[model samples]
Target: MSERQVARATLVVGLLALTVLVVVLVPRDVVPGGPVTPAPVATVLSADEVERAETFSRWARTWSWSSLALSIVVACWFGLTARGRRLVERVPGPWWVQVPLAVAALVLLGRLVTLPCAVALQRLRLDSGLSRQAWTGFATDQLTTQGVAIVSTSVAVLVVVGSARRWPRAWPAVSGSLLAALVVLGSFAYPLLVEPALNDFEPLPDGPLRTQVLRLADEEGVHVDDVLVADASRRTTTLNAYVSGLGSTRRVVVYDNLLDSASRAETLSVVAHELAHARHRDVLTGTLLGAAGALAATGLLGLVLAAARRRGAPGPGEPGIVPLGLALVAVGSFLVLPLDNAVSRQLETRADVDAVRATGDPAPFVSLQRRLAVRSLADPTPPALSQLWFASHPGVLVRVAIADRVRAVPG
Candidate 1:
């Protein structure tokens, strides 16, 4: 096949494989119990909580948009401007060293310019009583996050540089596969490596809750060995649960606060939601999508770089051009936010559906959704534009509405 045809076929096969994985991982039997029944919805929070939630949502949008604008401005400066290109030229080193340095400098520069907005958001969370972490802890967390970004960006740049140096004509093919592999590796390794660095995890104690969780997992066809709990209360009051890792590292994790505060029914609803993700092997599905996305992105990057070269821009292997590549990736990623969030919202909504099916009721699911919003001060009705591009899950009111429609279980 010609290279173009070959690239197209490879992309199609990779995406199909990911779709197959997603299909194979989910429990086919998971469905609405006795067809969803309508139930009366009652208030789950006090007037004070509702007021705080509204106030939080109001200014939160302003800060969030401000932060987004600043980040994009910085990305454009580093990617499109002569000044950013000059910064890289000022650094003296070999290609490998220079590329990593450029990646680091750009990453650091982005962080510096956006730090004020990040701090402002954190302050909002703390003041709103959502976060309990101290300033020192928050600052340390930021540094740690930046460190990870630097390492990840540096590795990606190095891979591109090496691939280009050795296989100029075939770099797109090789780098695409490599990027996909990197995404898969990170998905599998994140829980084991990166997550442990952020919080302590231990197996949930043997109790009625644990027994119920294990039983539910078995009922759902998920092979969960244990449920782990994170001490998330140390940082935030946000209640959450998730399934992470592939193979041996895979497990369901719940926030300790989830257990501490939620009723058995509410907690079980959360566990059921997480179990749906595990049953479907959502992590692997995500990895496959990541790989496919990488392939598509690498192909576009090739086209973009070629166009730049036609206009006398430095080639990929030339010194100080890594910033240009990083810039391309950043802008491309930013542009795809709406698409990403759409997929995420779909997955999340599916999990919500599964939880209702697994539990045979929707009251707890609805109640938990309400409490989550109140606890986190999430915006119930964010700007539609922002929700389309940025929200990873449906608005709380929407979730409650979905639950309210579920068929009431026979009394």
Candidate 2:
């Protein structure tokens, strides 16, 4: 088969595989008792609280969307134009050295363009009492994040460029498979390698809360190693908890703010939600689906770059392709965001269900949701499209309604 034909076939097959995995693995009807009808925001939150949430969300969303749009525009400018190619060509180095330098330059340039929006958002968070992090901390966090991005993207670009140079015709399939494997490896290693860079974690300590957490995990049939508390209070006042890693690295981490601010019952309610994720292996499911998505995106990228090459653009192995590759990835990730979030919402909702069921107490679950929304100043009634596109978890009102339904159902 022609190389073009092979690229097309790969794209089609990768997309089909991604679709099948989503259909089979994503939970549909995991919430028991009955369908949940979300209660009105006014029913739970005061008018003042709702107004504050709406205002915060409005400004936060504006800044967030502005940053995203600006980044895309900058990426396209650097990726598709003659000026961009000239910029990369001006760098004096071999392809190996030039690729990483070019990637860093383009990535940092994009960040520079969006830095104002980031600062604005951070200011908003500070004013709203959501973030406790100071300017120096924020700067440090941004650098750390960009450093990780540059390193990971450089490695990916090197592999792709290397593959193209080695096998002109089969690079798409080879690189796609390799990248897919890397996604799994990244998922497994993220908790160990990345989490430590941002915060310090200590065991939840021996106490009633620890005992209950362990006992609860036992009841849920998820293994209990230790619950770790993150030094999240240094960064933010918002309460949070999550289960991360896979297999041996698996851990349940709670924000220290949560332990200090919430009641034990409420804390257990959150732990139960995370335990549900562990019990169902949601992380593994997400990792596998992400690997498939990455492979599909690679195939799509191959086809697009091939088309560009026919139109006289640089070949895949050229340094000029670096910006274009990054731009394509940014655009592809944006386009697929809603679908990704849709699956995330389903999984999160399923976890919520398990949280209430395992705890067998809807009161704490309901209160916990309310407290989280209040603490985070979350808009209980967000715009429908925004929620559909970006919200990873079910809104607080819907979660409260789910708890109510579970409580109403006869045993």
Candidate 3:
């Protein structure tokens, strides 16, 4: 079969898999009864609070958008121009060594370009009382994040180049399947490998809160072996919790700040929400979707690179393709942001519904949402475009409305 035919087959299979998974796994009617009407911002937040959140959000969006645009520009400049190819060709090594080095160079360049925006955003968080991390700790975190990105990208590039070199015409099918499997493997490994690098985690102590959390998990039919507390207060003041990993590795992780500041009920509200995610295997669903996406992206990349080669660009196995491949990935990720976030919002909403039903009380849930928004200085009503593109969870008002709707349902 021709390379184009193979690529087309891979793309179609990936799309079909992704579509079927979304339809089968994603929840449609999570909230009970009619459409929910969000509570007015004024009802929950004071005038001063609303103003502060809005001002912070505006600056936050500016910096975040600037960083994204700058990164894309840097990637495109290095990927689409002769300069990037020349840089890669000048590097002293074989394809294996040169490809990894080229990927590192491109990633580092993009990170450096966007450093100013990152600093500005961090400063904003600090000033708003959202972040308590010192500059040294912040710098360390940045380096750690960049290191992970470089390592992951280098591995992926090596696989692509190696596959293309070994199986030219069939590289797309081979690489796509390999990467998709890697995506699933990475999801399972993340809790074990990546979580430890960022924070110190300790098992939640034997206490009433722990017992209540375990009881909640039991009631929800989630098999939670232990609850872990992260030393998040070392870096930030936000209250949050999440369930991470697949199967045996899965555990509930809560912020220490939350344990210290929030009441028992409020803490359970948060944990219950996370337990809902676990009960529904939302993380697994997300991982499967991501794997499908990687497969589809690989096929599309193969097609585009084949076309580019005919127009004098580098072939798939060449070191010169590294920058172009990275650029395409950056653009594709940005383009898909809205769809990803939309799915995330739906899952989050379903979790909220389950949490409310599990607890059979909406007062603490409502209060918890308000407290989180106020403490984080989250805009109660973010701009529609921002919510569409970037917001993973629903807006504060929307979450509160979900609780209210649940409460209003006849018993």
Candidate 3 residue pairs that clash: none
Candidate 3 residue lDDT tens string, 321-361:
99899999999999999989989999999999888888888
* Model 2 poorest ten-residue lDDT run: 402-411
Q: How much is the lDDT of residue 206 in candidate 3? A: 95
What are the Cα lDDT values of the candidates? Answer: 0.78, 0.89, 0.91
- The residue pairs that clash in candidate 2, if any, are none
Give the lowest summed-lDDT range of ten residues in model 1: 34-43
RMSD of each: 3.5, 1.2, 1.0
Find the candidate with the highest lDDT and give its number.
Answer: 3
Give the distance in Å from residue 140's predicted Cα in candidate 1 to where it truly belongs. Answer: 0.9
> In model 2, how large is the Cα lDDT of residue 346?
93
Candidate 3 lowest-lDDT run of ten: 402-411
Q: Estimate each model's TM-score.
A: 0.90, 0.98, 0.99
| lDDT comparison, 1 vs 3, better candidate | 3
- Residue 264 error for model 1, in Å? 1.9
lDDT of 2 by residue, 1-411 (tens): 655776777788788989898888898876666568898878889999999999999999999999999999998888878767888998888999999999889989999999999999999999999998999999999999999899889988988888888878888887888888888999889989999998999998898889999999999899955699999999899999999998888999999999999999999999999999999899989998988887788788888999999998899878889988988888888988999999999999989888998889989898888989998999998999999889999999999988877777623
Report the C-alpha lDDT of model 1 over 216-321, residue by residue, as the tens digit: 9999999986689999999999999999988888899999999998999999999999898887677777777788788777766766776787777777667556
lDDT of 3 at 177: 92
Give the poorly placed runs of model 3, Cα more than 4 Å off: none
Better of 1 and 2 by lDDT: 2
